[model samples]
Target: MRIHHDWKGLSPEARGATVAMGNFDGVHLGHRSVIDAARAAADAPLGVITFEPHPREFFQPDAPAFRLMNAESRANRLGRLGVDHLYELPFDAVLAGLAPEDFAREVLVDGLGIRHVTVGADFCFGRKRSGNAQTLTQLGRELGFGVTVAPLIGDGRNEYSSTAIREALADGRTRDAERMLGHWHRLDGEVVHGDKRGRDLGYPTANMAVGGLHLPRFGIYAVLIDVLTGPERGGYTGVANLGVRPMFGENRPNFETHVFDFKADLYGEHVSVALVEFLRPEMKFDSIDALIAQMDQDSAKARAILEAR
Candidate 1:
């Protein structure tokens, strides 16, 4: 998909694209509905207009930094969803201060030459979130563009949302989060070297230094990892520990995955891990033998879950 920072980045041939505008944090089912609507509106290419760093992160640093998907991952998912263009606008004080009409004029009309636009029914934009879907529809009529406010869709009981997904993860409910996300929650990071304690215990693991990625609740999980590397590169269903190794006296969170039946060195290599199901909560083992026994149980559980799925 073509990506642009500004409308000028669009060539003479790039006018008249249909746009789905929003934060698109997770690109979950709800977000997909709006994008699908834009795609259905023919005579224009499908485009997604999203913000970087999420305006919430910019305006309120102290706010919980929970995010369903990072910017790059969001773009990747949107592209897979058939988006022809993904406009990741830099969110800053200047852009944040735009009036409703100016935003429509400068972004939707002038920048994108949008032939049609789609957004959630509750979508709001412009300075202080003053603009609503009604405002967008009204402006579209004046600007010769079509506008659609997609209805909220839920999995029967409750509406699916990124926030809800995060909450589910925080509660160690991978299955619930997957229901909303339409897929397993995942993270990508490099496999850095670690204290070799797992090796000492006869259970080697690939360690990744956790960063800003929103981690799931502290627990052991059944996970599938794709090693993006050499001839040994492939998918592996494994068990992962995402917490401080309390049994070993570590007081900081760590991510260690033991790939099943695979003996490839992943040091310094990047891999993406998808959390499939929660196996158990983090527990302090009285001895190394006890930890190994619990790990054996976790591995068996993970294999069963992965195989069943």
Candidate 2:
């Protein structure tokens, strides 16, 4: 997909596309439905309009940090979904204060050259979020563009939403989160050098450090880690511990994965780990030997689950 951070970067031909606008935090199932609908309606390109540093973070600094699909990950997902253009704008004080009509005129019409607009049913924006779906449809009629508002995509009582997915992950409900996301919850990071605790136990794990991005709740998970390169370039069954290594006297959170029946030197390499199932809560063992013994059991269970899938 063509991704442009600045308005000036968009081509003249790009102005008349169908546009879908939102934060699109995790780019979950609901977000996909809106983007796909816009793509189907547009004779021109399909443009995805998103904001960096989600406005909620700026507006409510005390709010829980967002569970976001980072720029690279979002781009990859959008490409997979056949998006033609991605417009990621900086969310600042000035942009945040734009009146609903002003945003529709300046960004949608003037900048993006949008012929049709799509948004989630609950979407709101511009100057105190006064721009509801009804407002947008009204504006679209006046502006000579079409507006499409998608109904809430859900399974009976559970609405498919990024917030709901975040809650699921935070509570270690991987399967529930996956149902809402239309895919497994994943973490992307580089393998970092660790204290060799896993190696000493004969489990040899690749450790990843969490960043500003959101992470699943602290626990053990059955995961599939795809090493970015090398002979083992594809997915491998593994068990990951996401938490402070209380067993080893570490005071900071870490992601440590033990690849079943695999051996490799992977420090400094990047990988994407998909959490398939939550195994158990992280616990401190009285001895390293006990931790190692428990890991053997976890590894066996993880292998069985991955095989069954």
Candidate 3:
């Protein structure tokens, strides 16, 4: 899918399209319902209007990381869902100060020339979030566009939402998050060189920094790793440790994945790791041998869990 960073000078092919608008953090089931609403609006190309850095992050720069998926990951998932264009609007001071009517007039009508737009029932926009779905519909009437407010999708017990998914991940409940997301919760990054301690311990790992990415839990997890851009471009069942390495006296968090029985140089390669299940919380071990022994056990359990599926 084509990603348009700003709405300025949009191509003719990108104009007059139907768009699903929101933050779309995880692009979970509820977000999909909104997208489906846009698709049902008319026989127009499918597009998405989402914010970059998220409005929350823009307002609260010092807040803890809470993104379910980064921009690249979100775009990849939306592309898989058949989005033809992604309007990733920058969330800066100027854009954040836009009035409700001006946002609709400048962004939807003048910028994108959208023929139809869809948003969740609870969606709000513009400065101070003063506009709701009703406001959007009323604006659409004046702006010469159709508006759809999709109802929240739920599983009878819980609503499918990014907040619910974040709560599940914070509690180390990957399965629950997956149920709401309709896919495993994944972290994507480029493999970088590490201390090489895993090599000496007989468990070579591909390390990736988790900079600004919302960490699930500082623990070991059963994961499925996909090599997205490398010679080893394929999926592999693996075990990963997502933490600051308390045993090694490291403060910066990173994801270290040890691909089971696989040997390949993955430095500088991009990969996506899906958390399947949480194994155990990270703890400081007295000796290196103790850590290796626990790692051996974690590997066996992860292999069994992965193979069973």
Candidate 4:
């Protein structure tokens, strides 16, 4: 997919696409429903209009890291969904200052040249959040473009939403999150060098930082790994620890994943780790041998869980 940073002065190729506009944090089922509406709205190109730094992050800089995925991961997901154009517009001071009509006229109509736009029923825009789906529909009437407002979606008991997914993840309900997400919850980043404690323990792991992402339950997990870059690019099943290393002396959180029966130097390579099932919370063992024994049990259990799928 082609990603455009700026909304202005597009090549003819980038203009006049039917696009879904939202933060699309998790790209969950609800978000996909909106995107699907955009696709069915017109025969034009399929595009997604989202914000970098997420408008929430832009407005509340001091807030906690709650994003499900970073920009790279979002782009990767959109590409897999066959998005024709990705307009990741900057959420800056100038853009934030626009009034409702100004944003609809400047960004959607004139700048993006979008043939149609789809947003959720709750979507809002403009200074002080004055615009809603109804407001956009009215603006579309005047501006000669189509507007679609996708209704809320949910399972029987609860809504399919980012907040719901976060709650499920925080509670260590991996399958619950996946049901809402339409896929496993994944953390994407580069493999960074670690202290090699796992290597010494005979379980060499690929370490990834959990920067700015919402923390899932602090536990061991059965994971599906995608080595996204470098020569080792492929899929693998493994076990992972997604918490601060309690055995070692560290307070920062990260994911340490040991690919089953695999040997590859993965430092600096980009990868995506999907949490399949939560096994247990991390614990500090008194002896190294005890920890290794527990790890063996964890790996065996993880393999069984993955194999069953």
Query: Against the true structure, whose TM-score is highest?
Result: 4
Model 3 per-residue lDDT at 300: 98
TM-score, candidate number 1: 0.89
Runs with alpha carbons beyond 4 Å of true place in candidate 1: 5-8, 12-15, 228-233, 267-270
TM-score preference between candidates 1 and 4, better one: 4
What is the C-alpha local distance difference test score of each model? 0.84, 0.82, 0.92, 0.93
Per-residue C-alpha lDDT of model 2 across residues 1-309, encoded as one tens digit per residue: 787885554678666778888888778998888988888876888888888767877788777567556666676667768888888888889789999998888878777778998999999998999889999999889888899998878888877888788888989888988888887777776788988888878878898767556778888889998886565677788899989877777778788998877877888877778899888888899987898899888888888888898
List ranges where model 2 is wrong by over 4 Å. Answer: 13-15, 228-232
lDDT, residue 107, model 4: 95
lDDT of 1 by residue, 138-163 (tens): 99888788998999899898887887
C-alpha lDDT (0 to 100) for residue 134 of candidate 3: 96
As a whole number from 0 to 100, the lDDT of residue 224 in candidate 4 is 97
TM per candidate comes to 0.89, 0.89, 0.96, 0.98
Clashing pairs in 1: none
**Collision pairs in model 4:** none
Candidate 2, residue 96: Cα displacement in angstroms equals 0.8
Candidate No. with top lDDT: 4
Locate the minimum summed-lDDT window of 10 residues in model 4: 152-161
Q: Model 3 off-target regions past 4 Å?
A: none
At residue 229, what lDDT does model 3 achieve? 89
